[model samples]
Target chain A: MNPSAQHQDAEGARLGMWLFLFSELLMFGGLFVVFAVYLQRYPAQFADAGRQLSLFFGTGNTVLLLTSSLTVALAFEALRQNRQRLCQGLLGFTILAAGLFLVNKGLEWHAKFQHDLYPGSQTLRQAPAGQELFFGLYYLTTGLHGLHVIFGGVILSWVLVQVRQGRIIATRPTMLENGALYWHLVDVIWIFIFPLYYLLL
Target chain B: MGKVIQMGEYFRRGFLEPSGKQPALFDWIFSTDHKRIGLLYLYSICTFFAVGATIGLLIRLELIAPGRTIVGPQIYNALFTLHGVIMIFLFIIPGVPAAFGNFLLPLQIGARDVAFPRLNLLSWWLYIFGAIMALSALFGGGGAPDTGWTFYLPFAGETTTNVSLAVFGVFVLGFSSILTGLNFITTIHRMRAPGMTWSRLPLFIWSLYATAWVQVLATPILAITLVLILSERVLGLGLFDAARGGDPLMYQHLFWIYSHPAVYIMVLPPMGVVSEIIPVFARRPIFGYWFVAASSIAIAAAGSLVWGHHMFVSGMSDTAVLVFSLLTFIVAIPSAVKVFNWVATLYGGSIRLDAPMLFALTFVLLFSIGGLTGLILGSAATNVHVHDTHFVVGHFHYTMFGGGGFAFFAALHYWFPKFFGRMYNNRRATWAWGTMVIGFNLLYFSMMVVGMHGMPRRYYDYLPQFTHLNQIATIGSWILALGMALMAVNLLIALRRGQHVGANPWEAATLEWTVASPPPPENFEELPQVSHGPYDLKRAGEA
Candidate 1:
């Protein structure tokens, strides 16, 4: 939303971001469809696989992502009120939350790998028919979501820099708003993902 | 290298208006101008088109006889696979939308540039890079993939032919497509000039709008699908491979879910192209404008639901097949509505069979044949009979090549005056159109005929019974190639030495024609205010 010498449309920028977020939702939506079909085919196996995942890490990452969404929205509001310091602090907090989410995910995957439960492992292949697919969908959905968190962090960090330089102040918050929108999408996908993968049991 | 010396600055200025600070080639590459970026896409897409077409000719020649005529089985397999990938991903999918749409969308909508101009340049770059990555799979690592463009599962998972990189290339291409859709949607929503209401918009923009939605909503599914392919290879996930206990049918479901709508993304813009040209050459207000406009969106929506038709023979449930077959039949209505409308528009008017008109009319004929044959293939019984046969191959070629490909050629002829401010030799263009159509119909129609007679597709060798049709199709490919060469040469000559034209050479009533033949750097000297219907014969200039 920075006021360029040329005309700018903050509203148009927001629309573009929302459209992009729709793509992200559908991308994950595809995996959800795959997961749903497999769940129907091997419901008991999928539920058993669900119970195998560490609930503590899943819950922790879920909470972390939900809270990160809040901080980003607040950051957008603070940018609007010209509280540059609070905006930067809140944005930084959002990225830190993303980092923590990835850490929790890494720990969960590491625990699985230690037990030979990851995709393509002999143990996973030897397990029940549907369980390997469950783990496959599990890693694919969460891993892609992790990539999003990383991307969200990078986008927010850029916005933070722009805010720090006074380029993204109250009168020009399009960049921050778009970044926040992206972060919120990452959170929303995790919300669907956590329920399907961790809570279905 | 692209420098074609122009007589006036207006024509050159539109494309050469250095939007970036860089010099020469870099300037063009880095340009954020919609016009320049469109030309960038035009050049790159054409080069890819030539490569793909030549490969196609070779494939046809190899299939001319029962046994291998040129390449070995492996290389022949590679040739057709690359041809399909190149033609589908690199050429036809981006055909009209990337090149002409970029150049014309802003011009028609009365905008200086797309809503996200810098992002427009990024889409073209992504396109080029994705194309390179996809092509590199042929020369680098293992060898050219014979997995086909669909990259069907289990086999794609098992194949050692650099399938991952090729799939990854398409994933990147999907991003480019999604971004372009986002930009076009935003620009249409927020950048239309005052009084340029939705109904007043040209049908081409409407087609692009519908196309953008399909691109945004459907392509991401493909992105994920391709990512799964990479996952299967790199991370050894093997979600769709049977040996790993993964369901193979799921791969078909996911791929077609995106790809069926992808058919719309490929053909819809050309439907838009035909819509624009019909009224222009017919010199008549389009019959049933609202119906034509609504049908573009209708085709897009209905097209999405019919992905299951592709799965009918994959052992899906009878109820599922019934529903999908019904939806496939239903989707044809909208397209039929469009074809009827085009014919009606031409019925009571002074029609000019210019080069563009000739191609557009042929598109109507070819697309009609294609769409009707699609009904035969869509019927569960008939479709199962011809599932992976040459009939299926012929069906798609008719729809994609004859329908979309011809419309792209029509758009090229239609817009050449506006794009270059010059005219090609019309006589040569007609001869080219004739040869291409004759060749195109002969090539594809025989495939459909032999396909019905039970010749399987993608077979390197054919039985003696299918030899005559195969030979005919081979000859057709030669003629098609000759016509393509003639058209390319004719247009290239016009780029430099042709006679110049005025603002409205064909007297089109769209906003684009109201500007200088080659539009200014900023499309309009003053932003246009629309006060009349786009096709009003009485209205020449803006209010």
Candidate 2:
């Protein structure tokens, strides 16, 4: 007979989380491939479309996401050291940063809407052939990334609740670590998206 | 924690037993037990299969005499589309992996449950949710999509049908598939018993491992592709619209990028099932365990790169066609290696021509025929003639249905007693198998013949010259349906009234056979220690 031992396998849980992150990377990786293919096919049009996107908003969102990622990472570290208050503070900061990023994104999309740059808008219909494709991809890639941001924020908030209840402490911080890992993934995806859309111009 | 539940009580009460304050039905719905979730998948997938099969019968009826004998062209188009979507997405893709893999992975690896049991339950729920969404398109606005399941763009993008909703439904299903893959991969990697090393792992687990990698890596491409299609239909994104400077071929590339590998997702586990069953029935160690295990990985790897083969007639460059055709041929080698090993395993053994064994043998025969014809389709010159004809249709059905579908039947028969604690009538099972084999070949072989005569597919009408073969094929459909009905009835009766059997009824040596029939809620009272290969019949005999 096998040993009658029962304990939570934190390492296995973390490994599963990391594997899930790999899948997330590849999900976005598919979009990146599409972007790369289309960019090669219509270089000038993509460059023009990229320039039309506001560098101010894109850069602001990128900064917010990067800051959030750092805070989430630090939150896990603080929780590991049993500094419950500091961990909660960092998680709250990360959530705030994510909210700000989405707010900035909403404003940027609204400006695009006002200018009729959305796919199927009258302005896009009148634009050059590749320009429509560029904007189409722009909306899809960033829009998908934004959804991830929202999901990451929600996961972090849940983890924050757990920490507040003392359920996720130094000895039991797998949930905290996994949430941070997901938040870092969201940030990392934006790192790629920022360059592809804003800086590529 | 107050009073321990007996193993027999757990089996009898099922995973639907109430926990804490929850009601019984709610317990089943939210149960994280892998066994309950596996049964959930089994019930839903079989229901979908019945729907798909009915649609298939209607298609045959319409084609019974070359011109539409049943439904109108519009309804016909919708029928075939729904049939393809239901079969591919709801049935075959999740078929073996979701049902058998969920039930057996932890059992085979000697674990209490999958690495993420809660996530496993979530996948089953998502499957149900996605199925509902896909079926909703059939009732309201624009009716079911008329675009073939492939949903080739420009047509798919421009169709008035509710392609958007159906495509989005598939997107959700893809998430379910991805989660299942992730759960299985992690379980295999981290949850093996102390002695179940890689070499000592069953071939079925190895095939599942290969299949899981494919599902994780490839399904996202499909998810993204479907999302793009949704954007195109809903927001008029025009990513694949020709007038919008998008190349329609790019959509094909993205789609088959997942879908071509998806063929493996549909078949590899069944191939794994065959690998598991052949040895047990033959009562021998598999002829070449390493070769069979390695070939599953090889097929998975090579299968991904051969997506371009599907796009041969999509007007890609000649060079692209040449490269893809060559890769397609290369992919067949591993499959051929598996067939060779399977036959070798049966070379000189105490062969039992049981229902499960008969089905496995038929799978080997039919899949070989399917794979060989695939070579004709793989060659650019030959494929040009049979590209969208009934030949391609015949070839695909043979491979998927004959190979994957039959292998699933084999697994069901092979593992039925173990999972349900009941023994079905062997005579009726054999009769069902015989009728199916005859009906299957008659149906698909005629399609291949008419295809060679140049009968185009996805049409409501055809020339008089093809009528005879079409009629024959329709007749074949009747037999196939009859066989399927009998098989379902037989298994249903077994579930309720069949004789109870002990564990290891087949005298197999896998870890599952080491536990009770309809295993306890926690799978093993104490995880059995593994000291040898999964098919060590010598050890099985000594024990």
Chain A TM-score of candidate 1 vs. true chain A: 0.95
Which pairs clash in model 1? A1-A174
Candidate 1 local lDDT, A81-146, one digit each (tens): 888889889999998998988888899999999989987788887888888899988988888888
User: Per-residue lDDT tens digits of candidate 2, residues B495-524?
Assistant: 988877877888888888887787777877
lDDT of 2: 0.89
lDDT of 2 by residue, A40-92 (tens): 99898888888999999988888888888888999999998989999999999
Give the Cα error of residue B167 in candidate 2, in Å.
Answer: 1.4
lDDT, each prediction: 0.89, 0.89
Q: Give DockQ per model, in order.
A: 0.60, 0.48
Worst window of 10 by summed lDDT in candidate 2 chain B: B1-10
TM-score of candidate 2 on Cα atoms, chains taken together: 0.96
CA deviation > 4 Å runs, candidate 1? A1-6, B1-14, B17-22, B541-543
